[model samples]
Target chain A: MPGFFKNKVFWSGVMALVATLILINMTSSERENITLLERILRDTYAPLQSRVTEMRDYLSGPRSIFIQKQELSERIAELEEEIARLNLSNQILRENEEEIKRLRSIINFRDNNLDKYELLAARVIARSPNNWFQSIIIDKGSIDGIEKNMPVITSKGLVGRVGSISQHTAQVNLITDREIAVGATLQRSRETSGVVEGMVEGNLLKMINIPYYASVKPNDIVITSGLSEVFPKGIDIGVIYQVTEEPNGLLLSATVVPTVNFSKLEEVMVITDFWPVSEETEAELPALAEE
Target chain B: MCYLIHFLLPFLAVFLQSTVFGFYSIKGTLPDLVLVFVICFSIVNGAGKGTVYGFLCGMLEDLYLGRFIGINAIAKALTGYITGRLQKGFFRENIIVGATAVALGTLLNAAVLLVLSRIAFPSFHIDEQFVQGVLYQFAYNIILAAPLYGWYYRSSRIGLLKLPGEK
Candidate 1:
């Protein structure tokens, strides 16, 4: 038989194996930060991603009402077409009004919770491409004071923490990823505490490692216990959906449904910093004990 | 123009997979559009080119969002090579043939990716829910395979992405 070294198929196989080895060796982990080249790539691609999102939103237009009124949508479309031909400006104005209402709500939420966080308003641009990682790309990045590991949130509740940074965009790993864990407590009865983590199941989170005797029930609200450095205290995590015993029968675990509807998430607030007391005031106790 | 189209097709699919679809993700999964694109692209081309294309595409995808590299590359390269090689005997002009290829390609891609992922990161539980998620994604790829294949077939017919030695 011909020598194996001279066989083209064998060489190709060898080459493939070598190539895979190189690629695997280059594989990275949960990096603390990205390289300059990655940043540039992210910066360049952010605008394209942003444009696609804008176009999708503009074309899809006020998704909830459109979806709900599916039966009337065809009639509405015909009517809108006629109106568009009659008065194009009127159509644009209507679209703008809808857009304005949505933006205003986001702005209003920040204003209402001005005391809670020094929030930076940002629009979600994209999400992790693969099924494995649950993350989103936000329009704001390092340039916007969005450092790595900063907590991102919405009016509904906590969203996730910033993962990687670019000049113009940052990847916010959603709370749904299996990797994330938060120190959580029962808001109604702070006596019960556990570690909240993402589940391999559906869009549900699991709070585990609670004492078997602790009182827990469905609809019980879970909030951050301030035990973790990344997230602060009292941020809403979710409501306890179902409670179950661990396989070991030692501790209890509960399924939690997140407050923020991640599917329809559009805008969010990146918490740059938060203090237990607002910056306008200082912590001090009056010398009342002297009496 | 032809080369640019060849490069841009998968990139556009990746962008779409990552961006607009993310907002409407049902049960936190979307169709593996890039995988679909690779299989379809391979069906048009042959094995040698398909394997190379698949590897490059997988590398690009891994670099973009992979938790660990080489998982997608290895999976996709195998998918591409097998699909491309198998396409020769079938009537690829038929959407059913292309769809079948995608269905099989999806299973193969899932096998490699998931097995490798589980081996590498044993922390991720491979339970009933995870299996269900894979099934959902596989079904989506099958449902979506036709339209993308049709686009590629039409584009190739029109000489849009014909490489220098493709024929």
Candidate 2:
């Protein structure tokens, strides 16, 4: 029996047979139950793994404390210098408050006449690994009134749309994802339709299907068209980098540099007030067309 | 005792490789200290124990990586078996022999990963760039293997080292 088991070919064949049986069993098992097992493992291990990571970090603490201390002292000096400048800015701000009050009276009158969209501020805690093509993780989630397909933006411009929402976290699929399609228009000439597509490298975006008749130039601002009901009209997407007339002679393509640097994103605003067009609204659209 | 060291050593090496060494890379290309550990384990322990340790370690790695759930488990088990078989033929249990074995084992591990990943994820395209990346990782792991094996041999001389002078 020992001699039979000791044969290399015999053992190899035995192992292969066992592995095949295990693989078959694993694959043929109930998928939902397997998914539940995976989720349970992930949930159980994630916190323990995070704690272990934290402990390891703590164990490797303060290797460069002396250098960091000097850096912190220099940073303090810089902050002290900035405090003086901020004091001057504070006085300027007081003077500007009076002017702002005057402007507010005018803006309040204008705002009352115009439609308004409510915005919510959310802080970003972590980003997905840099290797993942186009995804971001933000702190706010379904619990914070964030929903899938909500538009994420920054003070600078449009960032991306929310893709997944958990109770405490949300994943934003950036405008740079290949699957994400946004309706946009040229801000300068008011060209009504263009599709924004993500390029593969270097956080670049391209606006496709722009009409050749529309005069688009370099540096023309592109804004969302609000046709898809995902983003509101007039939110900035990017400035056009290059424009080329396609061989078809009907449509032009323009490469755009996104306004928000997806690499260094720290905070964003979730547009929560825009009611997405419902099935009822779709049903009423034909009636309105008849009218 | 050997099993506990096997568990702790690979975990420590991976943690340090990711954090202190900063040697993590894109895709499936990273310094494979676990492979080195398995090679050393197989050399010190016999083939049966080595194969078992390799399978368990590879399973842990698969769990951490969250992809191709059982592929590494199979590959590492095979590699462990081969290394253990080699131990019977060329049974020189010294630092130089261990280093050479690990270097060759690293190459074999990368080749196995490349072939398996290609077979498994055809659409994912692990191309020339990825192969080059693995070569770079191979060089890095080879450079670190000697000193790491030396340290293990010194600290855990019970199973790892059987010097003529030592009783």
Candidate 3:
């Protein structure tokens, strides 16, 4: 017994085991209510980490000239495409403005009923270790009015929602992670609703519980159903890749190709002020002041 | 100053992993610098200190980027302990020994993470991509092991911490 206690191997093994258990317990606990120690640790160290990142970027800047050149070329091409898009958008908006005037006179619908949202632009400061692309640490946090469940987006489409926050940083759980699910609808029909879940295989998104008879097709656009409180309705989620029938035959699922490139995600906009309108509130909105 | 450097090293490694390393990857696999740090440190520090360093490094990793808590810590601590035990009979300065330790450590780290995530969370599942990623990352870690070992060797020889074999 004394010999066992004296064994260094035994002690090391015991410590490792204990540490493992403690780590698991801490992670599995409810994430919203982070422990005070963890909060303090994150708040205290986040700034230093952010500073170190900036310093590393500054130091590495001179050595990365080739990458910068390649990026500049790509940015030029993207800008050209953007210009074409803006021209098309101008034409569409002119048509929509005329139609909207006619419709507004007839319907008496209020424009302010649309949820007002504030966008906070954040930089991608850090990432998870494994290249799992599950989550990323953004430079925005509670101090920036970023809160848990706020949807993070790129101009292209949905990225993820804010999960945990420190004083100066927040973790954006990517839409590709298994833990996240978005209520989505097929844009072509707009009648079918389903849940888009992150799949482990190929890091793809899967839309589940779609009705078996829904006429979902390849390349059909998917957007937020606004069924959940986390995200507002009509945000672009992804495009359907392939629709498949389940073994049970009651429901259908589709493979979704996420619109946002998780790998190239750098700058994202956080929706800060959007409040989801419940069915009951939406019903009663007409009785209130029109403004 | 030395203690602060020791504390900052893992955080810096993770910070870099999250930011700079995200841009640079080979075949969709990135090197785990913190794991490299643990393996190299264990080889220099021996099993007892290695275990402690591994645990601390892993915890920081979990706090920074891990999806689940403690998975990296458990994997890294075990790897550190095992590599530290290897330090006794093997030449710590040898490149092959250090690189081999890193290879084993990366695989162990991945295996422990996968197995534990499976056990702890019913929602988590494994696939071919995960397996391929683990293998790619293992090779990547091995490729990085030599330079990291060289750096660790040079740092330890600066007479900061007592060398493993030095009396």
Candidate 4:
């Protein structure tokens, strides 16, 4: 009956049921394929949000400029002291460069000897509303060749990888997110391979599956192991803060302090082209080059 | 015009929270203005209308984030419905009633979100900081409720101030 449908309780129950179905469907999906409504809403709001953000920054610039002026005086004093030291170092560096050029010419170095990393720079546009998920939306997406699983990093270190890509934006899962797993190894001893995982509590990474006998200690640098299909090798990950022996005594775990500061992240670079070398391939690289 | 303002206010609040207010977060926990808006809106409107607003606001947020599409929508809608149901039992003109509704509604919304997050991401574990942050948000919502309710009341032409002996 129309009366029954009009009842507040009836409508409330119906809405509840509809919401439950949506939640179930959404959670089960991989979240990459957004619905038409979602896509439209995202496309519509992203530009508005960008404009508003720019306006806010523009408004705040004057106040920041005043503060920077006071700070700049002190910075200038320190820089003046450094200029004399740098002048001497600059001369020494010029002499070293000439010597290196002569040595390189003797070795007959080619232009292709240096491997150039192809990168795309992007600005962070937004952050997740909830603290449960650590992610940011970058202003670049498929239009900028930012595909899913592409490694994103800052000048400091690795941030995360691209998750879902839209036309003009992409979601980057932070390295601190629990869902992310990174292959890492101790820089001092490359044979000591481990897996770096994010903790649920704080912005922290923990390296596990380390050999119990490996001489791992605090302050050991950790780098990408190149074992992952997603990330390439030689990327700086973090440094070990502490080492703990697992109860099994067969493996050890260490807490890592990531080099990238997630809280202050603004701009990042996406690695578009990089080949990860496997252990066997690395061993055979010199032989193959010889032929 | 009223319908457009109703939709625009929440959208603007969400945008500000995501962009500007995000910079002023305390210990990585920012006060959720969207939650405050829903509670205030629900207090002004009835249960049915509040639920609709809640759904719309939550849906917009989910779209912006592009993850867990219906989670926020369902939680906010239920919070709005619950707050709206409280209107008939208490004096709507009372600031205490409005603030109480915001505190309780925000706590409920947070609980529902945490539960849904656990269900979706099984590895998520509640830490002490998370609990503390939720409590801080509850207090923050209460502090924001008074001013927001006054603004909504003035705009709705619902008689802004309750004089002495007003029921």
Give lDDT tens digits, candidate 1, residues B55-146: 87886777676346667877888899999999998887899988999999988888887777776667766767678778888888988998
Which has the higher lDDT value, candidate number 3 or candidate number 4? 3
| Candidate 4 chain B weakest lDDT stretch, 10 residues | B158-167
Per-residue lDDT tens digits for candidate 2, residues A209-247, read 988888888999998876767877778899999998889
Residue-level lDDT of model 4, residues B40-154, one tens digit each, is: 7788777887887887788777766666677788788889888888888787777888889998998899888878778777766776656877877777678878888877766
Give the docking tier of candidate 2.
incorrect
RMSD versus native structure for model 1: 10.1
Off by over 4 Å in 3: A1-23, A40-86, A93-115, A201-203, A245-250, A279-291, B1-5, B86-88, B157-166
What digit string (tens of lDDT, one per residue) describes model 4 on residues A234-282? 6788999999999999999999999987766778999887655556876
Q: What residue pairs are clashing in model 3?
A: A127-B18
Ranking by lDDT: 1, 3, 4, 2
- Residue by residue across A55-83, what tens digits does model 1's lDDT show? 98887866756465666888799998998
**DockQ of every candidate structure:** 0.43, 0.14, 0.48, 0.39
Off by over 4 Å in 2: A1-291, B11-29, B46-48, B87-92, B154-167
TM-score, candidate number 2:
0.51
lDDT of each: 0.80, 0.65, 0.79, 0.76
Pairwise lDDT winner, candidates 1 and 3: 1
Range of the 10 consecutive residues with the lowest summed lDDT in candidate 2 chain A: A106-115
Report per-prediction Cα RMSD to one decimal: 10.1, 9.3, 4.5, 5.8
Better-scoring candidate (DockQ), 2 or 3: 3
Q: Estimate each model's TM-score.
A: 0.80, 0.51, 0.82, 0.78
The complex in candidate 3 yields a DockQ of 0.48
Which digits, one per residue and each the tens of the lDDT, describe model 3 over residues B1-167? 44566777797787667666766766546789999989998888788788888988988877665346777778888889888997788877788889999998888887777777787777777767677777888888888888878877777877554344655
Q: Pull out the clashing pairs in model 1.
A: none
